[model samples]
Target: MTQTAPSYVLGSSEQEIARLDGQAASIEAATRLLLRAAGIGPGMRVLDLGTGLGHVAGLVAELVGPGGQVVGLDTSARLLDVARERARDRPQVTFVEGDVRSWRDAEPFDVVVGRLILFHLHDAGAALRHQRTALRPGGLMLVLDFDLGSSRADPPVPLVTQALGWVDAAFRSAGANPTIGTRLAPLLAGAGLVDVQTFGVQGYLAPDDPRGPALLGGVVRAVAPQIMALGLATAEQIGIETLAERIDAATRATGSVVLPPALAGAWGRRAL
Candidate 1:
């Protein structure tokens, strides 16, 4: 039997974009690292998995210029639609709607990239294994995800911890590893990638960073209701509105909040 396409709630999309926009600098840094790690240049072919909003793919397209190609694959039509809309005039870029786990291409890619996608999978290790044959010899595989294990700082508010616990549970239910970033290097190595490496990047939603408040504020607004709807906490126990208010107040007071430390990258090259 044919499988149906996965659907994402509208709120999820907005939250994702907000997260990206809020963390734009970090994302950009990660992307540059991936490009440098992969040694991408004009005339190379790159495949980007989970191309949410397509900003990363668009950047790759520019890097590759007219001689190279960038294809972004995503399961969310809504996200892909947004990506395509943004990439309309760029002939070097294309977006495809499909499952990254099962999608096939006629030719192997020089680079395969998935930013913040592996943690969302039920069997991320298996998913990484599947990409082995999709890459050419010496090809690069790059991933960017949150390293939950890196979260060492204490939550400033007790309620914040409760809300975070709920969000973690919700992500776990969806088969995502909220802390997958820490295991990325090992995962890549196990997948037979050579020269595996990992790195960290941070974003603060505290008073000092201007971008932090707007970004963290957006995240709070986007995720508050979902956290409440998950049934993990009572409205009174961890009030969604209250969390928003606190995040807002914190942002205004500090400028941005410091997110728990996160791993920004894992990368390696396919063995020849």
Candidate 2:
């Protein structure tokens, strides 16, 4: 078997881990829309691949009602531990530690879902095959990820562009596809999934969005080491201490609408 290495851009750290919950919250609305598109509802068994901190899994649990069950899987035990802690009150939810390429389930699932997972994968195609096998007959598989290359700023914020460029470069250096979003449908089709469909959602940041300004700064800071190592940017260019301020100034001065990375979703069903 050919193995693909896992490249997690945000490494395990107390501060970085803490940020994930908020990041999840910021995107919760879009995720719910994708879930609806995937036909997630009561009495369905769900497998949440790359379920960081269990936010999406918990949402799926609620949508599936008490009769359904959700299994949240991840590669990091530390993150899974946090997921377990958050999901302790929900008996229908369980957290497991494993790699997506190799993890198996004793019983097949009705729906397999993931967010921001494929781009970081060594071989998204192989993972998609694994997901297909994990699904029961006629089961659904849905993934939400980004085409960072499609990201751009309106009226252009130099700082935002610079920051995002560094982020994209870092992902490439880590061996992940920065533009995996656009490729989701083809990848699903190649994996032999039928009725494949793809949808795209553009992100527009509001000044008050809790995670907007801070997220850019946090991501840059989190990947600071990699930025330096990759020579994508210098410490002064990243400007961790003042990125938020600069973004704020740009938005206020130009009434600029910050266009975050566009998200694309692809879904298909396994053969019965």
Candidate 3:
């Protein structure tokens, strides 16, 4: 058997990470789901993997309160710097810069949580195994990620559908699993995690919903330039400048536009 390399780190620098964090709402629903799945509470030791800019870590910190400890680990030193800066006043939270693959600490955690991180790993199973080892007996592990095939809406547009396809292809080509949500339960089961559960959240991206449009548009805008630069698809195909226009037209002409519904979460516990 061949050992897989660690996942590719997306944000290596503070500037690069800030750009990703600026569009954090893209995964806000998923974040909430992970938080719920973890069942975090006061006095629980929490290990946050791939803690980008510490947004999720901050939330976990609040959940754990003063009595608990929240340690956020990521591969980017620059990102850790930003996390440290944000957590200055929060003595309960600590930031560490290291690869999750080789991470080991003095204390095992009650909950090990990751948001939108496993999909990027070349060997997600291995990473999950590592996370399991970091957990104390009977602790829970929660993960939230995208399930490309779960995309559904009231109405649909051809262009948006096409764009989604292109985006999925790009993700797979980049060594990321775009359909991690669907497989999360099985993956956890294989990792010897018992009592696994998964769920999803559905919504549409339309002009009527300011947050929906803003969140979706931010993601589109962030990656559109790169997609165009690669010539994977023309601006016309992705409707780079006219996504809102197209969505609005589709909703009016039909009932809704095909905006991929976000996957909610999946979690299981280490058997005691």
Candidate 4:
């Protein structure tokens, strides 16, 4: 059984980068809280995988302070440029171009972070095992990903529900795991990390807030090309242009806040 692995559905494009930056605004605080709780602090050498627009990497830089070093690695050199520009003020933060599964450093990291990157991987457990090798003994490893199955519009907006399903289907078709969050503890343990533990961070975007709908719509928009190419959806069906407006309208009508998938954090430490 040669099952083809999933590809990166959300591509690296100017538009996609902008949308990601917009989405990052809403989730930064939550991510910071998770990183802090994960015990990332000053003097730690941290490796941030799939750094994207460098949101999480910036946060880690702040947490680690001037005493620590943060290296953000991504396959897209374009993204690495964005990350570098954004991190210019932070001397301790650096951006490197590489793949998470194969990139290595002679100097081991005190912590390894894989945020929103697990689902994109074909063999996430194997990837974790490889990453674990880069961690120093007793190094902390953090895996944060979205449990998108939990995302929905309160009062059950049909359109909202349908929209969620569309994203899930597209992701699944791409071979990504939209709901891998809740099942991370065992994955970490299986990767040979000890003291495996898990946590969840939830963010509620008020009914009137545009961020929630924007976040949801942005994802669909980013993956629309791939979605259409895969025959999982069509552009007209996705309504690429006004998707956010419609989602916001529906959520506002219900007076129910929008919940964008729970941020599940699973972490463990390498053997001491």
Candidate 5:
């Protein structure tokens, strides 16, 4: 089978790994809610796709407890190394370097999940169709992604809007879908998963919310190279050093509610 190479717009730098850690932290509560609803529990094995920094994998380990197993799959060995070190205390979690599209094993998992990954794929449904085979009977398949278009200030913050547009365009130029969150349910259904269901969560960030601004700024920094390469913006315009501070300032001055992208989640069970 012909394979498509990884085309993540965010380069796999150590800085990017750290950025992912912040992103995961910002979305931790939403993720936990989704995983619980997906029925991840004791003794269940899970496959965490594109498991950067192993954040989601570690969460699965917690949900499944000591009897459960979590294998974090990624193509970047460097990111996996960081995932390993961070998840060192969780004996149930392990990291491996491989593409979920083709990697398989004799032992199937009770669930296969991914966060912020479907948007990076050229054909998410097609990929999931094959990857789902690694699931045991009645296993769950869950995916969570961002609806970038839904992000906005309650009273309209221009700086936040412009910055978000820049990040969205960068993903578009790289042939990735930054706004695929709403399509998640249909994508899973197309992948042949049965009993599909959908749920979503979005953040309402206060001016003092450190995690929200930090994630936004970190994403901008991580994708700045793409933004520049695609001629979306110049370095001076981005002003990586103070972007987060400026966003905080804008939100505080207006007392506007900052809404980061909504995380859309979908899951379905394989036929028994």
Candidate 6:
């Protein structure tokens, strides 16, 4: 008998595009670090797990160049639509709608990569084990995720700190890990991967950073429903309509900066 696979809790909606747009810069920065850490280069076949908007896949496609191929897989058709649009000019990259846990193919790839996708899984280790089968011996697997609990702001912004707690609670309530970043190496090792390594990246929002508030606000608004359902906040407190402006105002008023969650990247090679 076949076992059922878990689904992605946060869906692919217009909201996903908004989130991706808001975090584009930071994502690009992390992408560079992840690709370099995994030693991705030209002519290498890559599998992008939980491809989402496919922005990362586009980056990998460029690095893999014309001779290589990129297969981006995600569970959300909505996201795959956006991904396709994002990659319309790049024939080397292809997006498919599929669950990472159940996805398999006869051909193996040189590299498998994902960002901010692991923590959302019910069983990330199990998914890694499955994805590993799609990798050739000694192929690389790189994942970038977050440790929300380690998030901090200098000079202490009470509201920002409190907001993170709500975010963590909501994620946990939805059966996701808010702090899965720091655990990836052990997860990889347990999955039978070799030479596991982990790295950390901090996302800082300067007091005068133009996009700082918008990014944080977009995230707050996007997750407001989950926050409310988890009883972490009430509708009035969530204030979806005004939350973004209010957060922007509050940070400016206090002369404080916002620090997004600390991100962590982990990589390991498929055992030979």
How would you encode candidate 6's per-residue C-alpha lDDT over 1-272 as one tens digit per residue? 13345435566677767778667666588768778877999999999998888878888998899999999999888888888987889999998888888888779999999887888788888888999989999999988888887775565766667676777777787777989988988998988889988888777777666565676566667677888887778988777676657666777777777777777888999988
* Model 2, global lDDT: 0.84
lDDT of 3 by residue, 137-175 (tens): 999998777787766445555645655665566667667
Those runs of model 4 whose alpha carbons end farther than 4 Å from true positions after fitting are 1-6, 230-233
Q: What is the lDDT of residue 16 in candidate 2?
A: 88
Q: For model 5, how does the per-residue alpha-carbon lDDT over 112-155 read when each residue is reduced to its tens digit?
A: 99999889888887779988899888999999999999888767
Clashing pairs in 6: none
Instruction: Give a tens-digit lDDT track for model 4, residues 1-272.
Output: 22244578887788888887876777777788789888999899999998988899888988888999999998888888878888899999998888888889999999999788998887888889999999999999999988998888787878788778888888888888999997788899999999888888788778999988888888888777667877766788889789989988988988978888888898999999
lDDT of 5: 0.86
**C-alpha lDDT values of all predictions:** 0.70, 0.84, 0.73, 0.86, 0.86, 0.80
Error of 6 at 88 (Å): 1.5
What tens digits encode model 1's per-residue C-alpha lDDT throughout 29-73? 656765666567788789998887887788788778899889999
lDDT of 1 at 167: 59
TM-score of each: 0.82, 0.95, 0.84, 0.94, 0.95, 0.93
Indicate the worst ten consecutive residues by lDDT in candidate 4: 1-10
Give the RMSD in angstroms, all C-alphas superposed, for model 2.
Answer: 1.6
Number of clashes in every candidate structure?
11, 0, 0, 0, 0, 0
**In model 2, which runs have C-alpha deviations exceeding 4 angstroms?**
207-210
RMSD of each: 3.7, 1.6, 3.0, 1.8, 1.6, 2.1
Q: Where does candidate 4 clash, by residue pair?
A: none
**Residue pairs that clash (backbone atoms under 3 angstroms), model 2:** none
**Residues 1-272 of candidate 2: C-alpha lDDT, one tens digit per residue:** 36656768888788888667666766788788888987899999999999988988998998999999999999989889888998899999998888888899999999999998888888899999978999999999998988877766677777778888888888888887889999999999999899998898777876544356677777778878899998777787777888877777776676667766777888999988
